[model samples]
Target: MECKFLLDDFHVFAVDTIGHPGKSAEVCLSPNNYDYGIWVSDIITALGYDKMLCFGGSFGGGILSKTMCVSPEKIEKAVLLVPAGIKNAPAYKLLNMLFPMIMYWITKKETWLLKCILPMAISEKNIASDTYETAKCSIDHVKIKAGMPSDVNPEDMKNYKASTLVMAAEKDCLFPADLVLPQAKKIIADCTVYLITERGHMHYLTEAEKRMIVDFLHDN
Candidate 1:
């Protein structure tokens, strides 16, 4: 994704999650332990940031949640975008995501499988051709391990002190807004929640949603 919009305003430090596809190390940290938090903290320290505003989406959101629970002092604020770890994904959602992938692997027909999955997984219907191509390439080449991140414990959420903004997609079958929003409000102390009615798990934020996020990051 092109983040020039965000980079134009703020100095963004983006890192590939370890074990995920990217130039980062191939070590996958266990979600059940503090290793993810520690690894992130080490990166922040190395970057010379005493405290930074952190934003994460999907699996990265799970890592951010873990960091908040274990090392809240390292983060000044946080934004979670359709984050995982709030609740386990429903079986149908998993099947919806996995079936197309399996078909693509067996058939080697990336375009057809992506076309089938996009409507079910992503919110945007009119995606750019380049974006679609990039996604297709990544999925075809990337080596990702199977397993969802463990759910964030309620006590951990309660212990996090940083101001947090959790944006949940209403059509997110993976992490339904109905299930995530209420639990987030009940746990995080200074939390703001937005249920994006037009979005799904793979969100495509509207102009207004983008403004809301920018305002929150700057104002809070």
Candidate 2:
């Protein structure tokens, strides 16, 4: 999704995440200044948003959800879409360590790797020609956070108190519904988990999915 879209719709303030393009981890790592969570906390205090709603797609979802664990007092609600924070899982932990190595080895032709991996990791029905481009665009945008950090501990996830909504695609190979469904139940025992039929790992928020999220927010 585009940043301008949110700016037009909500009182949106976008802070580029680390590891993506345009955002530098060095700056974001400063607790006194720009650490992702700290920066968000600073914004909340400065803007007088004592309780903010958190929403993220893909990796953004992972970071936003973790922020709820680390700084739960600042969040009122959370929405995660194909979020990537299940560090406790072996496959994910392996991906975190291997991704950099794989990237280095693949060189400029890295885009090819995404084409293969996205479909294999996610469900077959969700793969599309545009999916690789979209994934590459996001990688080119969000900065990488230090700590080579990946994966959210299951315990921290279980402790989160914010009203939560998680949507996963039934066909998503990258972050499958099987993993996500169980994680959602553990993270927020009472929250609703909806599976998007015939969708994949792509980040295009569909009208129905958007409506579901809006409804969840309205109810909670």
Candidate 3:
């Protein structure tokens, strides 16, 4: 959604991840390894950019993390918001969402959908109109992806050279701040982190935070 800031400031390419639920090829790379990093590295090569400033959130954040490991030199900088791969909460933390999700799938009722997403969003008001629309469409038509990227290996991260900024949500049921930050700071040689206070996995960025992200990525 920060594409507007990126568009205003830099040359941008909005490449959809090849395996995701968008119009991309209907194939998902294994989330357990660095195959996605290899895929992204090839994209950078094909795009003729030796280095890139990257931004991604949630699942995209996981892919970016993989890219940082696969070819660190190719990334000029990075920003990951409410990201996966750095850390993910245990399955038990998410158990509350399962029944609502199943009911939504079976019944296609908006109430069940909202109930399912509220655990992630933290509040009914936190769900954006477009987010709601997108979720509804994706669930109605596409097979939902169940896996988030696995946490990155500290060893694989050792050679990462890009200055990285990770924006973690404090109360996110998945990838909570406590779980993500220590590893981010340890694995990245030049890492900066911002904790989004009182927020969960699906809250919107404040105007100030939006500017901060644009400035961080644009600085290099």
TM-score-best of 1 and 3: 3
Give a tens-digit lDDT track for model 3, residues 71-157.
Answer: 999999999888889988997999899999899989988999999899889998789898889888888888777888899898999
Please report how far candidate 1 places residue 44 from its true position, in Å: 1.3
lDDT of 1 at 58: 75
Q: How far is candidate 2 from the true structure (C-alpha RMSD, Å)?
A: 5.1
Best-to-worst order by TM-score is 3, 1, 2
Give the Å error, residue 118, model 1: 2.2
Question: Higher TM-score: candidate 2 or 3?
Answer: 3
Question: TM-score for every candidate vs. truth?
Answer: 0.89, 0.68, 0.96
Total clashing pairs in model 1: 0
Poorest 10 consecutive residues by lDDT, candidate 2:
26-35
lDDT of 1 at 92: 62
Candidate 3 Cα errors over 4 Å, as ranges: 1-3
Off by over 4 Å in 2: 1-9, 23-39, 87-149, 157-159
Between candidates 1 and 2, name the one with more favorable lDDT. 1
lDDT of 1 by residue, 1-220 (tens): 3234577568898998888766888888887666777788888899998889998877788788878877889989888888877774665656666777777888888665675557545634646566677567767787756665667788876667888999888877777889888878887888999998866666467778787778888984
